[model samples]
Target: MPAHRPRGAQRLHGTLPAARVAARATSPQAGGSGSATAGSGCVHSRRSIQVVAFRGERVAGRISSGDIEALRERADLASVIGDYTGLKRAGTRYKGLCPLHEERTPSFTVDPARGLWHCFGCGEGGDAYKFLEKVEALTFPEAVERLARLTGYELTYEDMSPGQRKALGRRTRLTDLVGEAARFFHQHLFTDDGSAARTYLKQRGLDREAAEHFQLGWAPDRWDGLVRHLTNAGFGQAELVDAGVATRGQRGLLDRFRGRLIFPIFDASGRDVLGFGGRVLPDRPPTTAPRDGEPPKYINSPESEIYVKSKVLYGLNWARAEAQRRDTVLVVEGYMDVIALHRADVRNAVATCGTALTAEHFRQLEKFARRVVLALDADDAGFAAADRARALAEEAGVREVAVLPLPPGEDPADLAASGAERVEEALADVRTAIEFQITHLLRTANTSTPEGQVEAYRRTFPLLARIGDRVLRYRYIRDIVAPVVKLSADRIEAELDAADQEPSSSTAVEVAAAPRPSEPRDPQLRLERQVLQLALQRPDLLPPSWSKVGEHDFTSPASRQLFVALAAAPSGGLDDVLEALPDEDTRRRVRALALADLPTSDSAHAAQVIDALRRAAIDREMAEVRARMDTQREQLSTDERRSLAARIEELRRRRDAIRDGHEGG
Candidate 1:
């Protein structure tokens, strides 16, 4: 028999269509209320499919308010996350498909041991219960009951729960510990002897304060020197390993940033300590026997729980606020350049990791300021990178991309050593991306004659296509090219117009060539990571889940869906819990607890959810009605039940008025 639904209930309950329901919702029985599980005594009697939970047993718990809370606690988030993602082994954590949305490169992460997750890709973070509630649309009690059922636990509630408070405290301590570790490593860079790190920087022109400000330090060329120091500081090697600062693979234990000048990498938010980048001092490569043991010219902080290079900037955390303050960001090629600018009081400066400039890097700089000045070394690699960066920034819709070209053989370090005036000049006379590319290519291809002029235009104008500014592009062609190519300003203008009008024979070739500057595989990952980042940053800007949207709905399909889910479910930062998705290789089908993005904690908010739920249900029903009317309207009276059909039509009328009357979107 169907559960008896009171006609005068506080909220209406009915299954409208498959679209509005969870993937696991069961079909309604004939002559039934279409509800599988009745709301428990403590729960509101508005549930549809009776959500059942199991712990590899025959119904260990039911989706009641009491059991739900327990499951919220004990839900093995790894299992729940495994369903959508195909995770791979990434040290201690299992990484896979970013459930927040579609990702080719997994920025979505999960720490099963801690039952915590965070998507560096999108800024979503939280514990297991919160993740499910947000991602899967489970109410707090519903999530709790589901988890309890999944884990066979009894969620007996209390008036004053300490879980949230305790968890907050733990996070503070962990963050502090990471900070202390960064400080310790930074301090070692100063005191370590025979290290010409200071001499080298002085030779190159960076002062002590600048070095220290950037946490520039030399790792004591010894294998376990850091390990011993960290141990004395009461931090376990395991923790070090987990943080991705050191490793203990087969060589027992070793420092990851040994004998190198360390540059710390922090997220754009400027809060979480992500990781580090290390550059070897000159003459200290493996060939030089400084203490007889040192590695290569460069080393990076291994990807740790807090660090994903794809989502971090070497100096943006320190730069973003200043950039936000000053309305500009100084982008340099190396860590020394970033430090030099900072030491010169130009706080809005950042550098790339060992990786080349990427779209992900641009995305971080995007939020801080409008103008982006690229400080490149006046060398081949630097010039090449400048060209690439210009093209990339233009493609990404950055308006003011400037090139800060240092004097030949002199870097920011040398410039800083020269004096503050030199740094000021470099900062002041920044070249726009178009002007820089045009001038750089003219110099590269030898613009001495008509052929040279044609070659220069061929090499440079393609980059101009990316420049969103037409007037500026024409001006660049007129002012810069007229002089370099000995062409008149009018001639240059006509050439630019003709160039814009016709399709270049090399369009496809250049498009293909531009993508593979260093790694062809990077953009897809960068794009996915950016989408995840936006979704995580503003989940509320989106709706609840992807199931509600069409497959091709979002501008960036994966990111939009994740954003919607995050927005739909703001579960105490459940976006973080999504990081715990299990690896596909592990055969982890799913954790029943993590069905939703984040669960609502307050049952009182259940009333609040009623509006969203009704909207979602209405959408589902409307879609079904449209589909049915399109396919089966001819036989509408033949197969359907009259009462149910009438209810559907009535619901549509009510929802349509609400949607059109400024009540619904």
Candidate 2:
């Protein structure tokens, strides 16, 4: 028999055997007639039970319920939520545009008092943990762990052996190792052996302060320097290899990065170190040759358990808050560009990690800002790359994409080194993605000849056809394409129509048209919403006469259900009311009402709402009575006819009395 488990033992994802065994160990039946036999290596005692938990076929650990609750109580919902969106105070809550969806109005709201949030536009609503899970695309346990770390709350695990616990924590251990490796390299950057790398950085216009702020480091020009240093610091060779810092050579483990200046890449939170990017110094003495011959100018960490090249953006850790503040993100070509831009006070800049921009990268960028400006070089190759990126951004559903026009030979880093104002000026002169494409085609084409104009038109037709809005597409054709191509607007339109009708045109980029704003709702429904909003924001102002109103008085089923839930909710328990709501649609409606602006004179407004509801109810009854009289007049008896007529008259009188400010029964 096993010993009794302690209180607050949590149950995470697990198999049935683990669950049953854990229950038996904790239940009062232990050591009695109903006691269950323990499995292999299981130890049961009167006060403690030691067992392993399995999620599917893999070993898993659990977080205590008490710790999760403690984390929730300590975590500030507004602070965590405000990271992805700009929030302004609205009465007792905070309001912002929905980061999860495209909307012109502010429909996303946070109720700090209850630790809840909901977006009326997209219908995304949740507590802090759910919000993190949705925004970060993390699993439930990962969300909990992330929030716990942010709040500085330590968590305890249960129902796992030592081996299981270590296996579950492998990612954290590898991340810590990478962090230590970053520190080691950073310290080496200032040593006597690192003078060449230091000189190289200075020549690139980066001072010691900028280097330190970006945590720039130097990889010593040796095979086993980092390998031996990390091994001596209590990390195993396998761990170092797993962290992408060391590789297995014929002589044994060798440092992956050598004779280069290192740039540490961090997660978006700027806390966990994910990987490193290294730039080779031109003036350094030649080291041993590699088996693959001459090395490239730049080398980045290989993908491992913690890092994926396509999903990460360099400098995002430092640029997240600034991007949210400015509502734009400037993407450049290299780490130096990102560092240089930030040094020049263009703080919301990030770059890809030795790769081209990807759809995943654009999706991540959309979380922080609606607009993305590409600041790559203005050369031919850079223009081609920018076009590809614009297509990807559109496919990712990004709201706005533009490109900054730099000088013919200058990139962002070059401009920054020249002067801060130069970079700022270039940023302000950015053009829309379509405009840039059009301008590039015209400038590069030899428009003096008929062949050149036809070639330019052939290239520009696809770009125009990709525009989702018909009016916008036609405007571009009339204003730019017609003049440049030296063709009539009708000819271009016919060409576009012919291209669109072809089956082969499916390969062209498809842009989703923007959604039209919703029209105003019916006035009677608006009255019902106002009543519910009052109940949510200032229930104290609800008149005693409101008690006479039943669910049938409300025309909308959602409104009726919400009213019932609000009535049943305990005093001062808004959270309970939200929890009791039937579905997400109702909940979204409720949140919108709760966060909407209320009238200044709530007391008098409350009375007006009550009177309107009563008169509306009377009106509905009279309509039904008149409807019945007309429909059933031929078959109805004389008494039924008289009764229906009298009912309609009574309803009319009641409605008039209520409108006249006299209470009518």
Candidate 3:
């Protein structure tokens, strides 16, 4: 996960406070809360402070308490969260795979009535604003402001000059600038200056509709074309440079992309424009071409406040909904492949931005779908890339990873250009990551000679041994490996056993290191967890005497903190407890406890659990007393020693009494 930082930290270079205020005033809210209604007033449920300034002097009035409450009421949380992960109705709540972590079962839940969401697996729970803050890495104010815009609830800055408002809002000015730049390039695409780019697109089989749908653009050959246009639009040179659309040149500011076709990269929501990717034109005149050494085929925006190249995937904004629907994402290698696939109605496809597939990219993909299929060209490079991607998928804990086999030298774009059915047919017959690896090995190996067959077996045996499922391993050895190596299944099994016995082989190491499910090591910790779970799920069943159990009674710090908050929480006020927690980790613990399913418990069972906690606490206290007595034995006076002995006796009696009560119950 990206480290959390304030949105203001991403301000444009040389931007003044006044400019920031203005940008905030004009910037659209980060996201919407719900349907928009025109009204004025503060709702005041959970107020998050927003600090704005007037004439460089700090002030506090931009986001009123009422506006936040109103936005909360208007925000459709499930809809907003659904944009990140798929959710399904589960009784009164909604459940889905947790977006924060990888898991098979649906442990993430949203309760619209309480305006809260929690993950039982990861223990992350919060309201809509908290949800946005964690998922998007936005600050609280940014989250609230985003939802405010989405719900059309206008946020007002009080007692500020218009300039001040503009300055505060300038925090979002860079995002707006990038968006404006996209429009500038897009508007130029249809002009005569873009004729070369248009011809290029046509040759690639992309018509005007495709261009318009993708908001494709063309950069003119002029050095300062974009610079002049943006400067004329009231933006500063530093702002333009900071936005990653222009660079400092010897003479003056120069357009970063010139004489190339442009593709705008948007955020996952397809709302905010992050940056751009430009491809060099094929027929550009030498005089208008790049003055720098040899022109690279492609150029992308430099890393900026809004865009992290490794973290962003091209075409994800358009592909998210379809990817979620299909439970798969087709990852290709270029912008044209994504566009081409979408044009062919294969909408669940995205591409990396002029880089190799990254762990961050895979992490983002996991949130949308369970499976990822690499749709690269079926050349040697594609096969090798797939091999690397499969390792990353394993590390990211993606449920299923596959490779789409295209014609030996063709990619998805080529297939799509030929016909939609060609691309669709290839997708239908994808290979699992393991199968692709075995096939690639076989294709590269000389299997006709006895020596070649032995070499193949040596290479393939380790791969087969790594399979955790015994049945699957045997099936692969029987169906795929045995025929290729001309080895019997029994012989293969014997070889695997011999390899397992070898201490130095990589196969032996991997097999020995296979992960095993861990059991809770501490019984007392388990008892504490049970007590807390009962408190969260069946509070009414808790005996009145259990109220006497304080936070100190629980040994684990997390459990202690949660117990304190739970005790102080009002009836049906789980959100209040969550808000009172000190940090995200503790809050996650509380949410997980609340969402966990506990066995059926009667009042007696609840009492027994609470009694067990009391006994444990007593034992802990007794141990402490005994340790102190031993450490200070010579230093203690007779009276002090007698007092310590009495204390220990009392604790023992209390423990025995609790045990007796449990037995009676």
Candidate 4:
């Protein structure tokens, strides 16, 4: 009835007193097998409750409270997080910059007393297990085991016997198998049969050290080579298949990679070898025309339990620490590019594993560096990819995105092969996201005629509009676009706004659902916008004194909602706080703040601005109350009229108090 539960299945529940749990478990119908008896060997089979019993009460299926509580009690959340992020003591709490997203100041906090951590910037919050789950992308069981090992707390599961427990740790077993397979391939690469692969690497500028460093391998053309090695080493066929190293062919289970050069892909930590990227060998004296039905130049391990192509970066295991040290990361498109860049001494380099760049990739990179340089080919498709990636990075709150300028038909590998200085020069010529996008548009468009200029405008303006900062958007229109297109800033601004209003293909549904952007031309609304801008752009600079700038100070409904959100998160990222707001207008308003240049106001200047805004807001409220009193005076009863007068007097007094306070300060 309960889905034919497994013999060792466990139903996790809250803590219970030993006596009470045992009493309930020994009750009638708490069925068990073998020599298990009531009281001494009680087992609550239906509810899956387990109880400690006497030695004489033998049972077929075993259940116990085990060492779960011990595991939880021994885990130190602060120490666990401190390993990943540098933390400083903040009273009972520890604080550090959030690793989930880019931020200038620390907003991630850990409360050792409560065994919990939360990121004010990214809204990621959880206990130690959750922290590991997010940081390492580990599953719940994997996290538990990892922490258990760290704390030296051995966990015992009630639902699993010793044999099953050993077998149930499937991921660990698969990971070990993959690691061994990588070693086997590496060993194979150096044998007599691997001469051609060695030649290929040498020709590509990858020396012996480079190949060994990357753990380059050769998968023999014969299918049985890897199969025989792993089998003799005691790995089963199913385990090999699960690891994505072997496939079931018509003849039998065979190695997935055959007669190809192999590059092992690891997780960010460098311990787990998730999968492999294999490149096909080049033909001798290549034909003039390409052969039909030939496999693509490269093939990657299929999506498996251990490997998700989008989640694995080729060189991240090595690049993470280097990126952090350098404060920048280079994201390339291929494994060779990553290796070549590293050989050139550009150590902070990683590449996607045969997939398009994803937001997850950016998130992972953001943990190591604020800046990401996209090292892509000098072609239309490559530029388009770079533009898309830059847009994604901006949306993800990455501080800066740059594109490396390479020569025609060359990638980072080619450039590095020429000379390390050439690679350095190319890196030096990296262009900012918008600049690169503009260059891309100009390159693709025919700029010889007036219509071509219009085409460029059409292609580039939407990207410019994507910028959150209104001031910076206007600056771009005035400074960059005007001279080239010979169009007035006013005309360009009008068109940019018009183009921005067009619904994006990806976010059409969200655009329709979200409120239209507010017009902030009114002086009061402009101040309100500035307040929100400061909250987003310089969260660290926002002082506790500005708590006086409440929702009432914002005249616009959208502004009022945003103010409330910001007030709740005085030192939180706009993106994190925005997620809590129910109103679509407020969400849209906050996103707009992200693109805009931050207002250049220090804490003192901001305090004065807040004081002035509060005074104006009070005056506005009092004026409304006074008008209401004047309009309703005749129709109101005597008591009602008295109430109105009292309200108006109170409003005036509050307004006077604000003015007095400002003047005194």
Which pairs of residues have clashing backbones in candidate 4? 8-159, 468-595, 468-596, 469-595, 469-596
User: How well does candidate 3 score on lDDT at residue 179?
Assistant: 73
Listed in order, each prediction's TM-score against the native is 0.48, 0.56, 0.57, 0.53
Q: Encode model 4's per-residue lDDT on 1-665: one tens digit a residue.
A: 12233456543221111111111111111444212223311221222223321111222233332343345456898877887789999999999998667798999998887667788888878777667656754434445545655564434435456664454356556766787888888888899978999999999888888777788898887767788888998889998888899888888897788888899987665545778988778883112112454545567888876687766788876776568767799987788888988898888999888776777778778877999988755555455566567646855678899888678877788898889888878888897767776667767777678888877666665456456678877777777776677778888777655533543332221111111355343344555666677777776666654765677777677778777776676457766687769978767757877678643556755554565577667665554444334323322446665786788687677766654563333
List model 3 lDDT by residue over 1-665, tens digit each. 11332232321221211111111211123343222323222122433354422111354344555556767877888987897799999898899998877799999999887778889998877777777656654445656655655554555444445565465466357777887788888889999989889999999988998887788999888898999998998889999998899999889899998988999987665556778988877746424554554465677899876788778899986786578767899998778989989988898999888666777889889978999998754544555566557656766788888988878667688889888777768878798877777677767789999999877866665456556676877787788778888989768767776754442432333232212222122344556787888888888999866867888898676788888888777764688888878999888867877887664567767776777678768876775566445423433556677999999998888888776763333
Better of 1 and 3 by TM-score: 3
Best by TM-score: 3
Question: What are the Cα lDDT values of the candidates?
Answer: 0.53, 0.70, 0.70, 0.65
Better of 2 and 4 by TM-score: 2
Ranking by lDDT: 3, 2, 4, 1
Candidate 1 lands at a TM-score of 0.48
Q: How many clashes does the backbone of model 2 have? A: 3
Ranking the candidates on TM-score from highest down gives 3, 2, 4, 1
lDDT of 4 at 514: 13
Encode model 1's per-residue lDDT on 1-665: one tens digit a residue: 11332332121111111111122111122332222222221222332223221100111112333333334445677877775466666898887666665467778888887667778777766666556554543434344433444454433322212553343234333444455656766677677463577888787666776665565666666777777776787776677777666677576777776666776665443334566777777766632223433444556776654455655667775665467657788866567667767777777778766555666667657656678887765544455566556546755666677788778766676776667887788777788765766677778876667898766665665555444455766677677766777767676556544643332232321221122222222222222332343234433444333234332333333334444544455362644435333344211222222332332333223222323334444644544444333223322333343554676788778665643444433
Clashes of each: 43, 3, 27, 5
lDDT for position 216 in model 1: 60
Model 3 per-residue lDDT at 652: 89
